[model samples]
Target: MNIVCIAWGSLLWKPGPLKLASGWHPGGPLLPLEFARDSDDSEELALVLCPGAPLIPTYWAYVDAPDLDAARAMLAAREKIHPGHPEWIGSFPAVDGAAVQPEIAAWLRARGFDAVVWTALPPKIAGTEGRMPSPAEAVDFLAGLEGETREAARYYVRRTPAHIDTRYRRLIEARLGWRPLHEAAVTRMA
Candidate 1:
């Protein structure tokens, strides 16, 4: 089955093997993107589209996969989501035929894709499991992190797609209270 995985956050840039086929294109329906989901691997809370939040033009990348099961397994492994775990990633369904977004569905159908699987955590459900931290709290959370985890978070924020000078990115930066990458470089030079 021809499959495509939807990436809206960290997967956008660091997709591992998910980006092997056809690379990725800027596509998918606009969703309410926010950094509300707490990460089990890192201190920084990751972004997720929640219901009842203000909708924004969120970007998605599509990666081609010939095997649906393999693709799902790879994604699950990368995300560290056990099959039956009920935290966040597990809740996402592997939809077929682009059912999540009508426009994307039409395009995929036209391309002769056999299946489309998208995994995203809706904010409402995320809240039920555990409350997303506030901006101030998130910033405070990042303050205690160091080394590779901190660097990874910084890289993720810099690569994520959003409107120029997006509030989401700004909030993350301001909350992190870290100097911009450029500034840090200049400071090191001085």
Candidate 2:
């Protein structure tokens, strides 16, 4: 089965254990994304798909898996998601022959991929498991981070792919001055 893994954030640069058969290619899909999830330990307001977030560009790569199940397992492991939370790891052509998300399914069919997998983690804010954070709240949360945690959060926001621009990103940049990594680097050198 020809399988592909899609990503918009850390997975693009830090694809720790997800075995990939090819480098990430741009133009994967445009999905609603926002930096709303307060990660478990890092406390970084990580990005996740939010219902009303702006549609942003994503990247995709062929996974080195033999089938859909293997691809899901590989992605789940890489994402550190527990097996019980299978919903966090989305798959196309799920057992019922329907894609997890209709939009993604159309993209998969157009690309000729037998299946696709991606991190489908939902937005969580301030210890609220499914709450989405507003742009101001997201900014305030980052601004409140201290020392190493602040640095880590800044790193995460800046490291996100530049093309994946969203409403929250603009707010973060304006409020926290955490621009994209390349922009920051160029500014530092200037």
In angstroms, the error of model 2 at 158 is 0.6
Q: Which lDDT tens digits does candidate 1 get at residues 1-190?
A: 5566555666655666554465455554455566666576664557675554455543334445456566666676667665664233321233322225444455556666665555554332223544655666655555666898877766655555544233445766666654334422111010
Best by TM-score: 2
Highest lDDT, which number? Answer: 2
Task: Give one digit per residue, the lDDT tens place, for model 2 in 39-147.
Answer: 8875588888887667887778899998988888888899899766888888887752423766688899999999899988888878887888777888888999999
CA displacement after TM-score superposition, residue 168 of candidate 1 (Å): 4.4
List TM-score per model, in order.
Answer: 0.67, 0.91
Clashing pairs for model 1 are 50-123
**How well does candidate 2 score on lDDT at residue 26?**
76
